[model samples]
Target chain A: MTLDISAIRKEFPILKTSIGKYPLIYFDNGATAQKPQAVIDCINQYYQAENANIHRGVHHLSQLATEKYEAARGVIKSYINAAHDYEVIFTKGTTDGINLVAQSFGKLLQPGDEILISQMEHHSNIVPWQMIAEERGLQLRYIPINERGELDLTTIDELINNNTKIVAITHISNALGTINPIEEIIEKSHKVGAKVLIDAAQSLQHTTVDVQKIDCDFLVFSGHKIFGPTGVGILYGKEDVLNQMPPYQGGGDMIKTVTLEKTTYNNLPHKFEAGTPNIVGGIGLGKAIEWLSQFDLEAIAQYEQELLDYATEKLLKIEGLKIFGTSAKKCATISFLIDNTHPYDVGTLLNQQGIAVRTGHHCTQPIMDFYKIPGTIRASFSFYNTKEEIDLFIGALNKAVMMLK
Target chain B: MTITEKEQGLIDSFSIYDDWMDKYEYIIELGKDLPLISEDQKTDENIIKGCQSTVWLAAEKREDKIIFTADADAIIAKGIIAILIEVMSNESPDTIINAKLDFLKEIGLQEHLSPTRSNGLVAMVKQMKMYALALKMK
Candidate 1:
């Protein structure tokens, strides 16, 4: 079940574009994935053939859209191996999803109740909880990360107590590429009756997620990061938990009945989806998931692991290049800084050679605070990314470093 | 040589980027065309805060349109300011106030601009619009 890299490369049209006489080498998959023809065509097809609103009119077009939209939900359920379609709630993206939980769940926590979050959580995951904690007078606790960017679960007993209401952590760090042991975290949190939310924004593309096996209370991921359209995401909650939580917003679709006095809420998913959902994006996400499912997940993981190995070896060989987060278990993301060159200058120089990489704090400023650096240049990889692209990236980085020196 | 009507038209039409990949290169070229500001205008009062690159912007009102002058220490930032001025400058105060500058998203230029750069761009635009709004209030 080896991956066919050549065949996969053919699906993304942007790979052919040239920049300054050099072909574009994209290493920014952690920020967002390059869309394949299938996802593109799915979006175009919806606009061309089936451009209509869903769950509204009793007409043929409405029914057709409703069917497609629900089918997409089914696709997501199976993709994550969830037990039911009702458990999957569509969101604007991961940010919106976390905020929804923060606003709703955070309201329920009493004063002095603790909300434990790992230092490696993205700003999207951290800020929402912080805001909630501030508003409700709950204490926000941070789980420390070692120099390797791995969460030090050694102090788990000290962090989780009866007063701890929720534990939020990232499955794979976008900056350090450290893959956190989420199952262990969830199990420990549950022992004290605390709910857990896993930010799977980075891991969803690289690994298969089985919510049942992990037994997390809630999980969130963005669609765009997994070869789907932007502005669409998933928030999965266990039925009992979702059913117990109050609605985050009240609007047309989310309400069963509305009056000036009182409004009855809809069921699990629609209760959270307040306004018109991104119908086209949901369909595109379903298509992207289907396209991704055809490939062998294990092979994809192994190939990316090999690429990470090769990249780490090559980057370490370059003089004065300092790699961040040297963990045993990591995804194919490399965050580094070259000696005496600002990350912005490094990014700009690489762009001239048509090598795309993200530079800066990566929206994890606290992690930057921990590392005591302004920022690092991050090059994240995906399954379709090749070793040649890594070689090109390394070559450009070397040239950039030499010019700066 | 005086700036011509054709040149103004070309600058106006340049707002929408034809392709995103070529935008940085185009911006660098635009930076080359920008007139250098006098040393007097590069004071602390003109400096735009929160930009990774040092950018200084100054504005004046002429013939009911807000005229803006800007310079950046960084070449690409200067080029970006040049493009922004081309679209925003010399328009009626009311027109500038009402103008929906969707050019960045349409041209995919926002994707290349870092969030801080994007915020600085927004701040510049907001400052320009605020000038128009003040004129309208008067």
Candidate 2:
């Protein structure tokens, strides 16, 4: 089924806003996607109607809330094709999920065991591994990226030796928009008996992620980035893998039984999930995934590719605009710099023109270092965004560039 | 001019430009006119780490007057720091210490800046006050 851009845009209230005198042209989807009214209403409906804590209370409201929360787990499990709902653990966000793995699964690693990551990973992916490596006395290895910003996979054989315990990588580069060949990485890593965690923070919104098909041992994504509420994300671990792992945090709802002397953790997913959980946030994420699942993702992807191609062609025609991450397979994100212009200045000028773009190292300082620049002006898109918006962005960016120069 | 008068003058100058383009141009010109910091003064210690831009600020006390110089990697940020230095520099330690940046609000600057740049503005002000507070104790 073909999509209606205007109709879809109408679903988001914030899209109607203006920056100064100009209409808002939001291109910072990489930072966060604008929440659709469906997601917002789901959150509102939770607080307004289904307001109760899950998993503990004997009240009717608590039972309804528990049903809704677990139903969300079922939706997410199907969305990713997880073997069981127990494999999907609710988290604060992608960063929280990564830390959970680094700590819980991390406790299992031994000295001389290595963890492999790519240079394009966000700080969330890098710093946690470093912390755990130091604590566990494990070695850390990096899969270098080529000049095109794609991961150089020729040396995967060298990096994924038998000693490699876990190989963590982003499914798509947040900074460079490089869509990694994770299926290959999973295959190679598995052959050497290594568990792989996919940071799908940038990829989940753009395309479908089938965890079962890919057979990744672990996967992480942010709900907010996928048009859900903030403070909630999903951490999918293989059932067997999670059973072997220890709990990341200690709190209510995560215990089977507790005493002053000892505590036994809860089973499966709840074992990793602690505290009250982001009750409302979980409901919101479920609604978002439900709303998105209705559409043919292939249709949405094709339309988005058109926007990407159109924006790329138009942006390239502008003088002094050099786009980074010229990878053949990428999403609708373009990180670029004007000749001798600071990205901060470019972003500022664009803001005055009512165009919102992200400016900085995008939590990928190593990518910036690779490009030999301080930072880049990143313009990313979602399916609801139109070619018209991209055209306006092109015009505004051109005007901003001319003025800055 | 007194720091207050200098600040008022800046506000009045900014009010002349009806267009944001012209206002930013004026700010850029002001940045160009700032008493630039020397290369040696642009050390890592002097750098005010901003998420959007890198700002380097230098301050010294001659008698009771505080002399300040600053630079930024981004022109817009440089212009912003120029406005701060124009008012706070060459004022007494007591005045600098108690200085209110009401001028930024008055000229619609603080609210106009992106979150990152506004945070950098706060950092610049904080560093200047810290310098004044240290010298006042000495």
Candidate 3:
């Protein structure tokens, strides 16, 4: 591995914490990753030394805070390799980011225009467009998946007609762990004059993201998923698209000028960043990106792929343990169900052994509904997660399955 | 038998286990011995949707008493429901409706069998009581 897994584990205090008698074997990285000391310390240091409202304040502390906050925006912009800093708008997380686009972009759509999403999208991605559809008299389409949990892009021509105004899809299926062919899909949508919004909440943590390369009109991801603080995220929009879209919220900083008679919205990023932003969260996210930038994500991804492969092989050995997403080119998450076993029982059993695996639809109900299962025991891995942990996870899962069955 | 007495009996039975692992095993054993619902009775209408699993519950009134039968796709959930059924089945509608079921806390199964577990415990309890409520109306 390009990164030292043991040393990396030392950076996260929660990883060493014991749950009951057993040391914590955290396999729920898909839900949220444990934060490293650097990100934690960054937030602490911000609160300790630099606690001030940003932008408007001329005081020394406020200036310092504003500089740090805006600098973090630049870091995020470059992190995603967006063409301009203005393209990156700070958001609550992926949900808020997508909602920003849905709400703002919804205003631009005429009746009869369609918003196409995929079967594998999380509820957050699906519901927003559905809301827009309900409000604007627009049609909502689904890009269905094949038996292997991969999107059937071959059917894209039929799905993405001239009526398609926006194609919103996830870069990686949060529930299925399927790495979607986003670039090809983007090209397909663009051919039909549809703006594509990529939900990178799952993929951003696992792989390298270059928004410029993808050329998706908008991209959204959460900081917490990538070893950063919660309540902070990025919504990267193309400069022209963001400018054309109306402000997502009306509050301080979003406006350039306001009056009893009229109000004018602020430029590019600020128009969307309404009210005081998650100041410490922004600073902490910058630190997280800085810490993560240390390793080649390609290397980390390769290592994680190795771990996914190892865990898959071991998990399949357990009788009646069936994996949900068997897409050939998927990332490092395995959603599985033991024959006639409830995921809750298995997950609770794993928790007893201090192995943390998420047991629910993972906010992707349609995928679960598609699989005809309530939920699956999802064991998601990161680069720091080891083959040894996978072994323990497998062993614990086996025991849980035995008891459950 | 009184509901409190039944609850007390459950608490007394579970008090032997010192840890969660042993407690869960006992629950599983109870689940293994549970009389399952028939295929015909395992209809969509009888199913309680859990986020983690599917639970099927059916209730019939045996004269003045309520008889509940349940099965779960997950073993632990089935075991948990089995415990509920063991204590609650064949009880009077009033007794089933009035039972506090605080024995869950006494047995430390509250965390395991969470009432907020809309998919499992809470939904099971609701379905069981609905059966009682329906029978009481009849």
* Docking class of predicted structure 3: medium
TM-score of each: 0.80, 0.98, 0.92
- Of the two candidates 1 and 3, the one with more favorable lDDT, higher being better, is 3
Which segments of candidate 1 are over 4 A away from where they belong? B1-48, B53-138
RMSD of each: 6.4, 1.3, 2.5
In angstroms, the error of model 3 at A44 is: 2.0
Candidate 2 per-residue C-alpha lDDT over A268-292 given as tens digits, one digit per residue, 9 for 90 to 100: 8889877899999998999999998
lDDT of 3 by residue, A1-405 (tens): 378889999999999889889999988999898999999888989999999999988999999999999899888888899999899899999999989899999999999999999999999999999998999999999999888999987888989999999999999988889999999989988999999999999987888889998889999999999999999998999999888898889999999899999999999889998899999998888889989988888899899999999999998888877999999998899999888677788888888899988888898888878888778789899888999998888788778777765
- In model 3, what are the clashing residue pairs, if there are any? A342-B74, B50-B119
Which candidate tops TM-score? 2
Measured against the true two-chain complex, the DockQ scores of the candidates, in the order shown, are 0.09, 0.69, 0.62
Error (Å) of candidate 3 at residue B6 is 1.9
Q: Which candidate would rank higher by lDDT, 1 or 2?
A: 2
What i-RMS does each candidate reach, in Å? 5.2, 1.5, 2.1
What clash pairs does model 1 have? none
Clashes of 2: 0
lDDT of 1 at A127: 93
Native interface contacts kept by each candidate, as a fraction = 0.00, 0.65, 0.94
lDDT of 2 at A373: 91
